[model samples]
Target: MREPLFLIGNVNVDLVMGPQEPWPQPGTEVIVPESEFRVGGAAGNTALALDVLGVDYRLIASRGDDMLGRWLAEPFGARAEAWTVAEGATTVSVGIGHPDGERTFFTTTGHLHSFKLSDVLSQLEEAGDGRVALLVGPFVIPALLADYDELIAILRRRGYRVALDTGWPDGGWTAQVRTRVAAWVGHCQHVLVNDIEARGMTGADTVEAAAAIIRPLMPDGASLVIKCGPDGALAWRGNEHVAVPAPKVDVVDTIGAGDTFSAGYFASLVESSDLARAVTNGVTVASLAVSTRPRRYR
Candidate 1:
């Protein structure tokens, strides 16, 4: 039987606004388009995508004890276990989108920075055996990031299949950060990184070179997926490599597309254990996600 997936990461409320006529100068307001509030964060998006695909999974994350947190959890219902903190606000990301599909985000870390390893282990212990853990956005959780090595060791000892999506460190990939990230990748059974993240981590100019550098660090029989937006994705397992092209679509908003891809890829791998098919499914799902508006609570 396939193991159930457990997503561990940050959860936040996203206020996305877009297509303004011009940049707001000083106190003036510029509103030329649309706006919406939705759940945001790698783990939140991935868990929701898995829900849409009818995959059995659980979400373990931290949120502020506020209305936004409650709103965010409403979609997952019983499947979400969000540790609410009273001292701070829920993480919120305000995204400003341009007419050409580009967007910039202003984020407040809030409760996410306090998500600790102890909280994660408690959830994992209750998850039982034969489960896959997808740890997303370590960068956003400083407490968890500091204890990542020990956390991965504990998870491995408990027989969980570990996967990671490091999202992108704020200060770019410095030497120290790269070392730590490489160590985390070594402990994971699967890793998902975008083209820029791959290049930054490996100090390699091309995706192929970057993938080559990281592949050796991955555990034997594990897979590394490099997501290339528009172009497609590349999957590497041991000595074999497969490249799958993304389906072209009329893209609306790509806010959570990569997270959607991670969900599709890992869910398929849990079901089929075929890397090629998993990559194909990931691309297909990402295409669909980018073409539509962000998913809302059901």
Candidate 2:
């Protein structure tokens, strides 16, 4: 039986525009010949990726009590009902990509900021006695960080191992963000971060250096995973370090690639507790994401 995965974070509707030349400057229009809409958001994207990979996970997030929220639910399939509707509009992101499939995103987080501890606790109740894996990402609301200790305590008491994905630190967090984030790292079982985020968190110049710095901050047995885009990923469990290679493929939109890798990594763990295999699975999915035009799931 697979361990149940619980994703706590934002939900958003994505507007993707493809093949724009040189990108657009402010007040300028670049003709995008292709466009697509998908279910996205740090939390939702991971949960959706897990779903596509046939992993059992429940997404707990705030949606707007509006049509956009209704639209956001469409891609969730059977998990649609798990969304908690708030009083505002659903979040949206406008993503633009180059011919090489590199993407830049602009977003409005919307009602995602409204999530409260009550919602999270209620969602955890639904996981029952299954081994729960909690995943939290960068876009979570600032105020929610105030509940970090309580949240971690609850999950730990309930036998859930937590994983945190380091996202861009919001300026709104001011000086307190790093401290709060460090507290979470100490409590979570694993930390997943891209090269940029890892550098910011650990003050390291390279992915390996960042991993080394992050390793000492986490609990003695906790794991640190640093994603290096086309360069693949490096992971550390205690003193052992492993480099997992990404499969070679033609470049496409890298949007959601990291999140896809994370889903695969955690899904592999739920399927088999092997750390090396989990890292391999993460590389596989991330490679697939970058190789496809609009992203494809395995």
Candidate 3:
């Protein structure tokens, strides 16, 4: 049997509001037709997706000792091993989704920045052999960013199949951040990035060009997958490149679509070891995700 997946990263509560026609102006108020409160963050969304797929996975993250934290933990039960911190309130993200499917976020970093490498290492030791360790939201967590190199080395040394999703850096991409991201990609067995992230990280104008540039940076035999929002996704492994087209559907809210795609892609890859099928699974899942209401994994 394949070992359980270990998903490590940010955990937060998402307050999604929208379907508004035009964005509200600065210093003005506009009410949306709909709003929802749900569990989110890249790690949380991925874990929820895995659950919907009936896959066994463990979520490792930090949460604040507050009502929101308790609310978030209630759903995960035993699958989540979250460290509770008393220093601040749990992370909360206010997501504004426009009618055109575009989204923006106002977030509080909260306890996400408090996750320590030592905590992660201890979890890995407990996870034992052959498990897949997915490090999500690397750049979002300052603690993870500080000890990323050491953490990757340790996971690789312990025989874990490491997958990384850097997410988007807080301050748009820069030369220094790009170089650091490239270095992190070198150590991962599977690298996941959105089209914008791929272009920024590789200085390539197109998904194909970006994938080509990132392919060589990954370790030998590794794969890089770039998700193109409406166009679909592309996977690159060595000299091979495969493009999977997404199904056209009415998009509701795209808040956690990418993270859901990551869950589907990784789950398929782990189950079948087929790159082409994995990309198909990812696109299919993401298509379904975006067609539904925010926070509904299935």
Best by lDDT: 1
Which window of ten consecutive residues has the lowest lDDT sum in model 2?
126-135
lDDT-better candidate, 1 vs 3: 1
lDDT of 2 by residue, 1-298 (tens): 2756777776788898877777557997666688988887787778877887888877777678899889888777667686678788887888887777677888885776777778777666633454655556544565565576787778777767778886887663334766677777887778888888888876667777777666777887777888888888989887677798777788767777788889889888876767788888999988887787557768
Clash pairs for candidate 1: none
- lDDT of all the models against the reference? 0.83, 0.76, 0.82
- What's each prediction's TM-score? 0.94, 0.90, 0.94
Candidate 1: minimum summed lDDT over ten consecutive residues — where?
79-88
Please provide, for model 1 over 219-294, each residue's C-alpha lDDT reduced to its tens digit, 9 standing for 90 to 100. Answer: 9988999999899999999877999998787878888878999988976877787889999989988888888765
> Residue 124 of candidate 1: its Cα lDDT?
68
Question: Residue by residue across 164-269, what tens digits does model 3's lDDT show?
Answer: 8888887878988888888888888889889999998878898888887888888898888899989999888877788998989888878888999998887786
Candidate 2 off by > 4 Å: 23-28, 126-130, 172-175
**Candidate 3 regions with alpha-carbon error over 4 angstroms:** 25-28, 82-86, 126-128, 294-298
